[model samples]
Target: MTSHRNPAHSLNWHPDWSSGGDLTLLSSDEIAFSVPSRPILAVSPALRPGAGGLLPLPLSLRLVLYFLDLALYGQLDFLGPSDNYLTDVLSLAGWLDSLGATSLINLLLVSGRAQRWPLAVEFLLGARLRRTDLCREALNRFNDDGRWRDTVWQPPGTVSDFATLCPRALPLDLWSSVDRRFMWAWVVADVPDTPPSFGLGDKFLEIYQTP
Candidate 1:
């Protein structure tokens, strides 16, 4: 949150989405925006309005507006004010599962909006959302690029290069998920169980036995 500003004259409201709305959503930064609740309520049963006061969300005004704008209007280009901002939008959508906005983001990504964006953006969003379906969508794109076999699987680069695939910092849990599922798929397809033995394997086994 930045410095608190006057709610009435805050610079944080959405310029296009703040009018003709039925709900007053206040963000943690004390910025308020008027957004329609009908579309959201139709899709999400988790965001019911409270008795009579404005709804408060524990997100920045930018994020809240982005979520509402995307969810209600199916707008994909209104990314908020920051570098690599889609990551933040995906994070907020993933956290608010009850909002039912994740599907909209997923749809936009798979429906060609993500082609202009980094392919890794979809992959990282999948990990953030904990959706294997989304993860597979990203994986299929990578596979289509011929990177799965040539670069990701049998690489001069290592499996850790998958981390490099992400333009932003990778969280430990998401990385673990990617390793377990994403890399495991490649390993299963690429690794052979045969008589061929490698010195590095022997060395690793020896180190494990010594410990």
Candidate 2:
């Protein structure tokens, strides 16, 4: 059950974790038992494991991307309200949802995978995303209530703040919110809590600002 961290991609791995505890549905609710039904299944070349028919994962890394693959194949029932197979992963004793934003995006923002499962929002977020349009797609996927909805097991957030994105969405756009604090999960994942005017949007902006 040991894990290693790769902060650049914000991913952690347990190279030899091949045990039976891998429930059909993870507690994180990132993947599910049905994904073949979606018509616009999102795919990415970046996620491919390369020519060997296996992800040429980093040396000594035996990461089990089982949940990720399930989403790729479209087994995403956790996103829908109809699905009730989820098991709570978060253990906050006295925490409340006043902080807003329970999007799975927050979990990915911090844990690389939705390991802890944030539940402030009513729906799951991130499940069928194209790496290229992460932000707008997220914005477009927002329900009429202005909250992001989940319908699949897409990665919660960009692999890194520096991950490529559209020039116009601008990283700064993610802030300016009283709720949606999950988005902040990315800004503070590596560190702790948002720093004073840390202006993470600027870091995001810088990524796009450069050639």
Top candidate by lDDT: 1
Across 1-211, the per-residue lDDT of candidate 2 in tens digits comes to: 2122421222222112233122132233222221232222222233333323223443111122333323222232232222121111111101222222343354234433333232221122211121224444444444324643232122334434322333443443442221233343322322222131234334423323333
Off by over 4 Å in 1: 1-96, 99-102, 106-112, 147-211
In the range 92-118, model 1's lDDT, one tens digit per residue, is 343444433375465444433344443
Structural RMSD, model 1: 17.1
- Residue 134 lDDT (model 2): 46
What TM-score should be assigned to candidate 1? 0.27
> Which residue segments of model 2 deviate by more than 4 Å?
1-54, 57-135, 144-182, 190-196
